[model samples]
Target: METHTELVEGEIDLKYSLAERVKTLTPSSTLAITAKAKELKASGIDVIGLGAGEPDYNTPENILKAAAESMEAGFTKYTPAGGLPELKNAIIAKLERDQKLTYKPSEIMVGVGAKHVLYTLFQVILNPSDEVIIPIPYWVSYPEQVKLAGGTPVFIEGTKEQEYKVTAEQIRSAITEKTRALIINSPSNPTGMIYSEEELKQIADVCKEADIWVISDEIYEKLVYNNAKHVSIAQLSDDAKERTLIINGVSKSHSMTGWRIGYIAGDETIVKAMTDLASHSTSNPVTTSQYAAIEAYNGPQDAVEEMRRAFESRLKEIYPKVAAIPGFNVLRPQGAFYLLPEVREAAEKTGYTSVDDFAQALLEEANVAVIPGSGFGSPDTIRLSYATSLDLIEKAVKRIDEFVKTKWQD
Candidate 1:
């Protein structure tokens, strides 16, 4: 046997080498920021993390009870690769009840999470170099997942002036022979913007004419606030329903992020392809999570509404305060739990050249964590999640205000 130094110096080291595909992938910026904050907290630093996308609320009690009962009854065995029948029925009921959209059992398939569902969908739909239209600023995962499926992400800008929503004309302009799909994340992550019903109708018309598939990510649907309503593009018309894939889960609404259950509802052929791919990749969403999701969908939704109220109250309370920060330009978000504030002026005033550098300094100096917007394709902005408690949100914002004021004065 060789000594450690000989082993290092002598032979080929294939074990540590990454696959080319893996090398090209970027780790999630949201997760990276959260992890660093966690590391600092572990090392006895006082870090207030506003970077995580998960609700600070615990998984609802009824859902937990359902999962516990499932385990006790030996429902711990392997389930169908797509999902349990009971859970699928619950999802079907949810669609008809909430969106007035109908989906057959064959048109729905469950996956480990919305992220996994999206990955599987991309895998089944994309060919190498096929282009998928994505609007900026997008969820960090959209472009990366498209690339992972050997698809190119063609981005159309949704400027702040447009409320961060790309128009139908923008979508029409991006389509080409290679265009295969377009992703729309309403009540979007990082931005909290929702496209109106009329906007969806026009966008759906463009997709229908251009023969492009629409991937509607409505994960934050339940979290809409004020007068905003989340209208599924799939509900626009029969033609739109035929062309749209709906991705959703209990993660946001039921606070079940760790439960790992999400699903896709779409055309039968595409759903079958996703199910078949899931059969190989994740086997099935965790059996317990499936059962819990059944209860989450079928159970009384008071808890869901309660959490929504809390988020809405917090959003109303904080938006004005955040916007009032000197040099920070933040629009009042209509839905979701995040605020995407353009901080380029703030950064410059604080003597930083970029928002990324300012975010780094914020973490080091003020011990507050926010995701820099470069990861979301908007380099002038930063994302701050309000999913945490209103108290923490207030404290974090105060720290930010003081930090910016002090730096600007210096």
Candidate 2:
């Protein structure tokens, strides 16, 4: 076994640059915060964790059974580069059945996850200094992926007043000749803000006029609250569909994060290019995952609906209690399990000028771990998740309220 000391000693003059792209990477803030919380909890500290991106629900039972069946049926070999034809056909059916759009298998490319699909597209599409317009309070991975692909990220800050969604005008203003694409994650990760059909129509109009590509991350499409419908950019019009990359997965909806299955539906040319890249790269997502995902897409959706109802109930339970707190400004998240709250007001009055410090102080003092907004390109905020039990959410809100008030006074 290679010990750490021996590994460090033997790799001294290795052709590895201390100054490569990997060296320039910032670690995932969500993962870091989650780890710190776990460490503190292991030491017997009471910690409230509101930083996870996935739902609290377990993976649906039928999918697990499907995985077992796949293994039993000898589905252990690597599939086609894009995916199995059966899975691709299922994806094709899903787009038509769910989103009211049609596509062939050639227009559908599956990857390990939606993140991988987007990053692969970023590397393939973005030239040096090509710009991608990302909305503020965005996913933590967006800027990093853009930089990884050697592109510039231009962020347009959205607001609570505007329902935490970027407008077409903002998109129009942000675009330059260097702008290659825009990544829009509806039912967004940090904010849980869903773009309405009308809102998407307006944005689609702008993108069509600008002739730029849209990387629509629709992973949380099925988790909407109340009557808020998810609008796919691909469903807008022929022109809008021409340049849109529709990214979806079974992760959030089916509580299948570990399954590592996602698909991209878009222009056949781009899909083919991504498929070729993924074929040579990952070859295919896990054979079992692909099989189970087919069952997820084609299986009974009652479980998904049940989970959605639970999330909606929890959202109602948490919203008022969270709003009752003095310094925190929380908008009603439209979908997903997150809350990007403005905590800087109280932090500022208390001399904690940054959200990072506020998060650290809360973690150290109140023993609650959260992600600061600066990671998502907004400095005066923090992101919380209401994905846990109603009891936990209530307890967490009360504890947070008390902590914020007492700490601010000090």
Candidate 3:
């Protein structure tokens, strides 16, 4: 057996071994959570998991039918590395029709998922020491991906009071000479905070002055609740439109997480570069998945509406109940099926010092599972997704309420 040698002082040359860049890469925290949830479930534990970023609902029927039809028609061969012309065209049309931001098919590129597109864009566009502004509590992948691209990540932290959304002033405060990009996730993943059109305009104004590119993750664009408007930063003004990469997919909106078909629509130069990277990397998402994605984009949007309504109902229903839990302060979310709740009071009230401890105790004593806020760049909170069935959320919240009240009173 060949044994690996350990370095003592300086074993040969360490620089030639592995690139120092890859060493800084971190694992995706979202995947880390789902993996932990799976481990607990495999133990035959009744874990009411709220750690899932994907919707619990299955993909829509029309999408599945499209995949089946495409397969039957023998559309299984490898496609153009960038994407199928039909899918790219559909993406272009969607951008023009819905977003009112016109882009040619050349400016649209489909990848595995919105996450993949964003990560790849960073890889191709980022240079050493280029700064990417990320707002906290951001989607866990944003900062990691930026860092993996050898760019410095500048984080602007906000709290529940700010709705966990950053202001233009905050973005301005973080700007430096090396700043190259700014990521904005409207209707953000963990916090479910949606920025209004006016709010985006302010941020775009500052970004325009600084000439920073905007990577807008609009994956949850269709999931806003309370009739809240989800504004695309790119659509705010002509200046913003020229530099925005709008990312969207059928993952959350159509419950097609496994399908892995995501696309980017933006400036021709940036999108083409990203598309070329996609062509070389994964080579145009899966063929059948692209066909399915076409159905998701062009088919009846009613199913999307239904899912959004269901999530909204659950969000409203869970808020009061979750708020009733002693020491848990939940800000009603405007979009996405998540609640980034401050659980510090609950932890302190319950004699637990941290969110990880509180989350473990909840899973153990209450048989309820929720992602610790520590994973989402906030250690004093926990994310509660209302994407599951109402019965499960109801039962979990009840258990959580009972579990917290017995030990903590605040």
Candidate with maximal TM-score = 1
Candidate 2: segments with Cα more than 4 A from true spot: 1-14
* Predicted candidate 2 versus true structure: per-residue lDDT over 199-308, tens digit per residue: 88999999988889999999999989978888887788888888899998888989999989988998888888888898788888999999999999899999999999
| Model 3 accuracy (lDDT, Cα) | 0.85
Best model number under lDDT? 1
TM-score of 2: 0.94
Residue 274, candidate 3: how far off, in angstroms?
1.5
In model 1, the Cα lDDT at residue 9 comes to 60
- Pairs of residues clashing in candidate 3: none
Clashes of each: 0, 0, 0
Cα lDDT of model 1 by residue, 250-308, tens digit: 99989999988899999899889888888887888899899999999999999999999
Runs in model 1 lying further than 4 Å from the true structure: 1-16, 30-32
On a 0 to 1 TM-score scale, where does candidate 3 land against the true structure?
0.94
- After superposition, the stretches of candidate 3 with alpha carbons farther than 4 Å from their true spots are 1-19, 27-36
Q: What do the candidate models score in CA lDDT, each in turn?
A: 0.92, 0.85, 0.85
